[model samples]
Target chain A: MKAKHQRLVLALFALAGVAGAGVLAASALRDEAAYFRTPVEIRDGKASVGEPMRLGGMVAANSIRRQSDGLTINFVATDGKASVPVEFKGIVPDLFAEESGMVADGRLRGDGTFVADRILAKHDERYMPPQMGEMPKNMKAPATT
Target chain B: MHAYANPTRFLAIAKPLTPWLLGVGLLLLLVGGWAGLTQVPGDYKQGETARILYVHVPAAWLGMGGWTALAVAGLVQLVWRHPLSGIAARAIAVPGMLFTALCLATGSIWGRPTWGTWWEWDGRMTSMLVLLFLYAGFIALTNGDEGQRQGGALSRGAAIYAIVGAINIPIINRSVVWWNSLHQGPSITLRGSSIDGALLWPLGLTLLGFSLLFGAMVLMRMRRIIADNRVAARLRRLADDEGI
Candidate 1:
């Protein structure tokens, strides 16, 4: 094998090395690479507009207000310290709800409302699930005020 | 490229080059590893899970990258009957396939804490999974029959697959942003990009290291291909003369 041909191959592969790095770096820079934010993180204005974020907070008492439109409903979710108003414009799950501990996902609307597309009902220690284990140290819910 | 078709000759030369390539690969890997592990900070939002980004992001980066290398190499071998290219393709296959698997796995693990689920059938995640299957298919095609190992045929199949896969890659990548889905929107993008510099540098370096590691491995595998060819040809010639 000629040294020249070998050199050419080496150079080409090396160039590919550079190209791969460029693609990764470029995407990471764009934040196209996503990671999720928790309730605390979401409240800090940490999630991007389209980035799917999960927030868990309690349903503020009497904050549930269903609109006449049937689909669009307004609810306020709070972590006690801060509260974010949410608007859901879709068929909510039967368990759909509000409270500091309920988690929701979707885009935060321009009107400072969390336009939730999905909702999750959380369970605490006293409310043990059938398949779930006993509450772990970290998952032990915060004492209710 | 044909000049180095002889395995022994390729070996003699590549053997010398091996140490140097290996050294460089290691250096880049370590440097990138160090940079990613040390330099990147906890995310302003995710806290510690943000640390996973340095590793998870690059793993995904290299996953796509390794396939591109294999598919391209296959194309070259098919078009030109370049034995070296075939070896390069095969050599890259394992690494590429492994990284793709790693990317998907890591992405899911990252998803659990953030998305609250271990899996989602979102466009990006699903497409990346398909890419992993493609890599496996290429590996399966190359194994077993030496007759099936013709550099031309093997590569042609791979090349076709690669090109098709590349088209899907962008669609998978853009799926979260393009359509309403559970996946997170791109934090890093073409313009108006916004990520902390602390995260970017290390993440970038990790990618460099991963790419370098791939090149070094490809070069090593090419040398092995040359050796196998030499032995295979000699055996064939002896059998022909005996006419047994």
Candidate 2:
């Protein structure tokens, strides 16, 4: 091969090597790469009890119930097909509400309830101006507290 | 490619083009900023916070786009030994770093009220952070003595690093989809955009403006580098004549 062709081959090989390494590394760290687990993942026994992990899903409709103490609140996180009850003892994020996406950092209890230390609101990609009026039926309006 | 190989020829085109690009880019930016800030209604959910999208989205696009340019330049420098390619790569670094930093800062600010956190180690955020670090490392490597000389060993190493670092771009783009992330998935895709037309138009305008501005800045920096190199070459000849 000409010198130019040789260099091209070398570059291609280097790229392939880097890509292969990336694929291997990503696959190996799959567990760590996932920021949170869905209710379905937990239900499928992907998560172990008492091991600290994050649970992410939508807050089921009417699932939010505040305890008398006011700091502690209970809600069920659902991915439609499966649901996991979650408990948190702090002021929730402003966007956190029934039917909105949330990611809770905590652990699954032996009783199956997830005890959360932190709660983060996860908004979807859609962006519509308020002047447009009512959101599409499939999309839920964020609850105003 | 050969036409641009001559620095004077390249400068002739770049010098005249830079001002036009900058002028049009700034005008578009002003219009986009006005429309995004005052003309459009607040988001149905995020309210006024969504206006940040105009600046943040453009910065994020250019941040990734800049690196893609660097990688392509690096590839040309390595394979073809193009004299101008190395200058182009060096010129891209600072602006690329600035855009990446801008993206991170804006994202963090947006995250505070929206995500209820200032930062997260989620896949999307983490990968973007990695991109920032990669830019930093590339800048440092290229600025060393090797980079000062055209096509030096360290410059080639920098080129290789640029090629390797490109791996992160795709990772950053796909992070929200490939992993669970606090950051949202892509709003605009090959399929279509989820953002409303009212909001999307300003975003489009800003994206184009920022991209043009980025191109102008890169050309200006390349011209500056070329001029500095010429002056340095003249000074070296003068020193040799003086036997110093």
Candidate 3:
């Protein structure tokens, strides 16, 4: 083959390699990419139950309840507008605390609850989450007191 | 392409532009850093740590962009046989690798305070690390180990490696969306930026500054490569003439 033809053939192989990797990656991403939602989204019926997803919000004050198993903890995640009760089975992260922003990954139970397999603490760059001085006017719970 | 195909013409254009790019880039970076640090409000969510975005985002962008430029040059060299594209590809690798490393370091530092971990095998972070390795590999293949004589095969192999390694760039970009990782989703994108205008403007300035600096470095390195090639050609001719 001429030098040009040889170069062309090599280039074709490189392009094929890239295309193959992209297709495989796309397939993997479809299965792996989990979408994030909020309590408001769950309340609005936007979050799909039974599908694994990520929920991020502040852990409601005085909402944490540890089960007898000692490994499971229950809490309500609130975002000033809505709240979702979350049941997570595992040791919560060190930063996990009431009034601190947190994210949980798990499926939504049929009974309007989040069954989290993993819990991650979420905080802003400031070493603190937004202080809950007063509950929003829309808050239905008297947990603010 | 014709004008730049010749080293003399390429230098003629690059010589004047390098200083302008480098000087303005440095100045804008300083201004952008000052503005990001002092002027911008502490983020409601991220607070002062959001300032890291000014440096980290630009470094990530340039790192990704540098690889894209290398791939394009590799294509040019392989397909069109552009005389100078090989030199351009070689010129791009070192600084590109440095930027990739910088992005990872800054990102790791930012992650520690925010994500509560120094590092994770998160999709985004892991892919970025892979990109750094790709850059290192490309540089090694093209430049070869010191003291060993490298042949044309290494250059051809480098060009092919560059084209193939480009597969990782998109992977690095989409990794956050693709995996359940600790990293945040995209903030600035082509569709529309989610950040406030106050934060976005300084970020833009820093991006431009860093991109210009990257361009200046590539141009400067290309000139050196061209000069070195000229000396090598002269030495070869002298040896041939002397029958040595």
Candidate 4:
């Protein structure tokens, strides 16, 4: 091979090596890599009781209920396949509402309820102007705080 | 490629090209900024907060794009021993770091209203932060190598680091998909964009404007590096004549 071709081969080999390493490393760290587990994962025994972990999924419609103290709230997080009941105490972030994605960080109780220390709202990938009046049908219904 | 390796020829092309790039780039940015900030309507869900996408998305693109440039230059430097490649890589580092930092800052600001947190250790966010640190490290390595009489070793080391660092780029791109992240998945894909056409056009303008500006800045920085090297070589020659 010419010198140029040799160098090209060498560069290609290096890139392949790096990519292979990345794939292997990613697979090895698969469980740790995910930021959160869905309700289905928890139901399938992916999460352990009293072990801190994040549960991520859409907040079930009409699932939000505020306690008398006004600080604590309860809701069910669902991925359609399964649902996990979640309880949180604090000022929930703006955009936290029904029919939207949410990730709660806390622990699972033995009884299967998730006690959240922090709650973060997850925005979906869609964007449109409010004037369009074509918001997702479910989002049109206001959250019953 | 080799013809441009000659600094004089490179400068001949770069000098006149810089102004045109800057002028056009600035004009596009101004128009795009106006359109994004004032012309476009607020998002149905996010309201005015979504306006930050114009700046944030471009910064994110360049941040990742800059590293890709570094890796390509690094490969050329290693394989062809292209003299200009090192200068090109050095020129890209600072602006790239700045854009990466801008992405992080803007994303954080956007996150506060959207994700309700200033930062998260999720896959996408963490990988981006890692990219910033990589840029910082590359800059420090190349700058430290400057004083050495035999410059090839550290420069080559930096180039190799640049190539290796590129592994993070793909990781960053796929993080949202490969792992669950607080950050949303890709909004614009090869198939189509999820954003409405009304909101997407202004974003396209800003992306183009920011990209043009990044190219111009890199060219200007390369010219500056070349001029500084010329001055340094001249001073060295003068000192030699004086037997200092």
Candidate 2 lDDT by residue in tens digits, B115-215: 99999999988998998999999888878564565332236688889888898988889888888888999998887788888678999889999999999
What local lDDT score does residue B88 receive in model 4, on the 0 to 100 scale?
A: 86
Q: After superposition, how far is residue A119 of candidate 3 from its true place, in Å?
A: 5.9
Which pairs of residues collide in candidate 3?
A: A125-B46
By descending TM-score, how would the candidates be arranged? 2, 4, 3, 1
The estimated TM-scores of all candidates read 0.61, 0.95, 0.75, 0.94
Q: Model 3 misses residue B60 by how many Å?
A: 0.6
Residue runs of model 3 more than 4 Å from their true location after superposition: A1-13, A29-119, A122-145, B145-154
Model 2, A1-145: lDDT tens digits are 8887787788879988998898888777777889999999999999999999999999999989999998999999999999999999998888898888999999999999999999999999988878553656676533321
Residue A69's lDDT in candidate 3 = 95
Off by over 4 Å in 1: A1-145, B1-13, B146-158, B190-193, B241-243
Measured against the true two-chain complex, the DockQ scores of the candidates, in the order shown, are 0.04, 0.50, 0.18, 0.47
Q: Which of the numbered candidates is closest to the native, going by highest DockQ?
A: 2
**Residues B1-244 of candidate 1: C-alpha lDDT, one tens digit per residue:** 5797665676787788777777876787688777666655555334465566666777777777777776566556645566566677677777788888888888777766654567765557877888888878877877654633333235345555554455446656676665434555575665533454555666666667677676677767766565566577788789999995
Q: What are the root-mean-square deviations of the candidates from the true structure over C-alphas?
A: 12.7, 3.1, 7.3, 3.7
Candidate 4's C-alpha lDDT? 0.89
- Candidate 3 per-residue C-alpha lDDT over A1-145 given as tens digits, one digit per residue, 9 for 90 to 100: 8887888887988698787978687777654443357799789987788997888788999999999999989999998999999999887766678988788879899999999987877653221113321447475422211
Per-residue accuracy of model 3 over B92-142 as CA lDDT, tens digit each? 999999999999999888876666667766677888998899998887777
Error of 2 at A113 (Å): 1.2
Best by TM-score: 2
